[model samples]
Target: GVPLSTNEDSTRNQNLAALYVLPQTSYPTFYDVRLFIDPGYTEAFHGNVSIRIIPNINIDQITIHAMAMRIDSIRVVSDVNPNEDLFSDFTLATDDTHLLTIRLTRNITALQPHVIHIDYVAQYADDMFGVYVSTYEENGRTVNLVTSQLQPTFARRAFPCYDEPALKAVFRTTIYAPAAYATVRSNTPERRDSLKPNEPGYVKHEFEDTLVMSTYLIAYLVSNFNYI
Candidate 1:
């Protein structure tokens, strides 16, 4: 035999129900029951059940590439409110050619509306394609020259980010070089453009704003690389 009771709570618009079952057989038997609990069952369950709801957030794709040098490391600085770190979750790869990928972290929910800063270093390799360097034969004499126009492909061969024409972000770059190189160019106009005072052979150049662009769209060139 079973006894049932139902009551309605008008204030909360909830139905509270209870059921009592009495054993009719000598042996215990299993029974299948279904309970249609209200959507707001916190009070009825006395807060014993915990439910977690995650919001739907959009994540942007990022990619990177490196050129002319081997990338030793990549660092990602998160802009979380409590200052959380997100460097450990990024994926990095590099071949002798210019290409890298920065896979987004799975828990990108924590990085909503935040800026990520990436820093890396690369070493110069001999230009096999003569893109960054130029060669000319004058009167049967061999002349070798370097040019800055190869920045789009050569400079970007360092780290992975968005690498298309339209996908762009604000970026700041500082280039280190020997004392002879005096000129550097970036997509954005220079702001604090100067050489490192104490450091003899390093030039610290910065840009103010960058147009929306892909990672490959970023370009920089350094010539006669010298410090102050």
Candidate 2:
């Protein structure tokens, strides 16, 4: 339930009862997401997401949605001047669930595109939601499958995003996992896959960029299930 708006603009006038349904102040046009899953572990699936956004007005801060995820680092830089406008201030808004605010030292020009890069780790929950773990019995042994079911507003549970249907963006997603241990799938077809150098028993699978779609439509899964 992330909305985009400049800090100076105060136009969230929707009866004040449905503040959660307000439209975003910033719009995302494209995204590049990378994920690493260790199914062997019980928690902490790492991920990195890069988003290209266009704001309606000049803004010094950008806000998105996230829940039950630990943000490791956030880097925001203008495409025009990567070194000049780097921001370090990251905090949560008051009394808001899944709301993440990033304050930049300088205001970003309106209608221009800026890249927001985020590194975070999310837990694989037992419930089916954003990147959860599903279990089954294989050959009399218990097995776990790490998967996702981001529908409606659950995308924030996996990675930071607008987490609304109004915001549409193209996505390029990649996954890294132990080779031959699991199969990776996403919204788009796999573009390529290869063994990761210097890391044995690991492989990287890159997916083609998705058509412009809402965050709810974007998905990925890591599992050992075979195509029968």
Write model 2 residue lDDT over 1-228, tens digit each, in one string: 788675545444544435565345688999888888867776778888898989888888888887787889888988888776567699854555567888888888889889999999987755777788777898999887677889978888778888888788898888888765567888878885532233446678788888889998877777787861
**Number of colliding residue pairs in each model:** 22, 4
Worst ten-residue run, lDDT, model 1?
A: 44-53
**Model 1: residues >4 Å from true position, as ranges?**
1-69, 93-106, 115-119, 123-155, 192-200, 225-228
TM-score of 2: 0.86
Question: Which one is best on TM-score?
Answer: 2
Alpha carbon deviation, residue 176, candidate 2 (Å): 0.8
lDDT of 1 at 36: 14
